[model samples]
Target: MVAAYPDDVDTLVAHEPPINAVLPDAAGAARARAGFYEAYQAKGTGAGMAAFIAMTSWQGEFTDEYFAQPAPDPAMFGMPTEDDGTRDDPLLSQRSWAVTDYLPDAARLLAAPTRVVVAVGEESAGTYTARTAVGMAGLLGREAVVFPSHHGGFLGGDFGYAGKPAEFATRLREVLAD
Candidate 1:
């Protein structure tokens, strides 16, 4: 929105956007993504989530060693081993790849009047989204603003992955106020 209608936006806070092109090994990330999707298609949500977790939790770049690792077991992550026989998951499927594959236009963003604040969770250090947030900030010549909790910091307990939503909101308010 900032790129197309910069004047319309006052402040744009992009929190941990998973833009793979920002990563050093974007191709490897895509391969890793395919690995998870294959797992989802072959097995189920459990296996796919396990692979996704493995990919996201990886500390550094997706190396050959990363690919060489054994396929993550759904049971290891307390996920169901049985296949639900359904696909079309927005997260585990190729449908969401466009989101991660987007290459931000730095020139247009920099030229915009909107204050583009790229945010990363404090607990998301060294993770894929964290790196992307930093990279996005770098593209705009700024540092990522650290928020509380993990990737879904602003989310409540509804998703079974509760974060510091109150604190996150407070911090967001602070940033927006600035």
Candidate 2:
């Protein structure tokens, strides 16, 4: 949207938007990218999803034992462990490397009139998404704006991942208003 309507938009609130342009380590980046595919292919939906949960929940870069880490239980997160004998998962089915691997056009972003405020979850300070948000903001010559909750901070009662949605919305509104 920024590319097509640079002038039409005013402020962009980027909440943990994974812009990989500024990731520090290439090897670590590749490992993280392959994490989901390896997990799902090796352990089916239940365990793979568990692995995915583990991956995203990681506080920092994937450790040396990341791949060896036990698959997380979907039941723990109120997610369905049993695959319904179908392979149509929009989230896990495809390796959309393009999105996570994206390196946004920093020049265009800076030149555009839109004010991009990168938002990161307070609890997600050391996580990959938070790091990525910070990286993107740094590229834009700014620090990410802190929000009230975690990565899913704006989420409320969805998939057992509860965040301070009301507070999050208030903070977001404040950012937009500024």
Candidate 3:
């Protein structure tokens, strides 16, 4: 997968029942601290803090999405499918299904000689989109390449790790030449 920080994001993003529901702000912070301690007990302070930040950020984003969706019920709200069997519980089936069901289709697409290129940014260390790209590549049995950027197009600005269309065209030409 194109994950900048695979382990941390996956842990936070995979949690069921949503983090906000289980821990309030203070409790959440406390739990994060404890988790950091446990995680870094052997690794070091940097690893622990990184885990804390990743989990906390994931909690915030997931909480926002959780609150934005309708209340619990299969027809209205549920766990995202991609996360369903990955976890032991079920909350939003439809959402989970939507996220998990794309594998076959993605594999089919990647199987074509369409020059699939999975790009990751140097800065998106713990973002879900980056993680998702990496995961999709793995599922498709393809290798994802990391591309460093500076400002716009594929190499810079807020475009993240996404390749610019023009850059892709040029890269395609180079590939064909070889």
Candidate number of the best TM-score: 1
- The TM-score, computed over Cα atoms with residue i paired to residue i, of candidate 2 is 0.87
Per-residue lDDT tens digits for candidate 1, residues 1-178, read 8988989999999999999988888898889999999999999899999999999989888999999999999898889999988897899988999898888999999999998999999999998889889988988889999999999988999986789999999999999999
| TM-scores of the models, in the order given | 0.94, 0.87, 0.32
Question: After TM-score superposition, what is the CA distance of residue 141 in candidate 3 from its true location, in Å?
Answer: 1.1
Cα lDDT for residue 88, candidate 1: 71
Task: List pairs with backbone clashes in candidate 1.
Answer: none
**lDDT by residue for model 3 (103-147), tens:** 234544444444445444434434433444455455557544443
Worst 10 residues of 1 by lDDT: 21-30
Residue-level lDDT tens digits of model 2 in 41-106 = 665677567766776777776667775666677688666677655554455555566777777888
Ranking by lDDT: 1, 2, 3
How many pairs of residues collide in each model? 0, 0, 23
What lDDT does candidate 1 reach at residue 82?
96
| Candidate that scores best on lDDT | 1
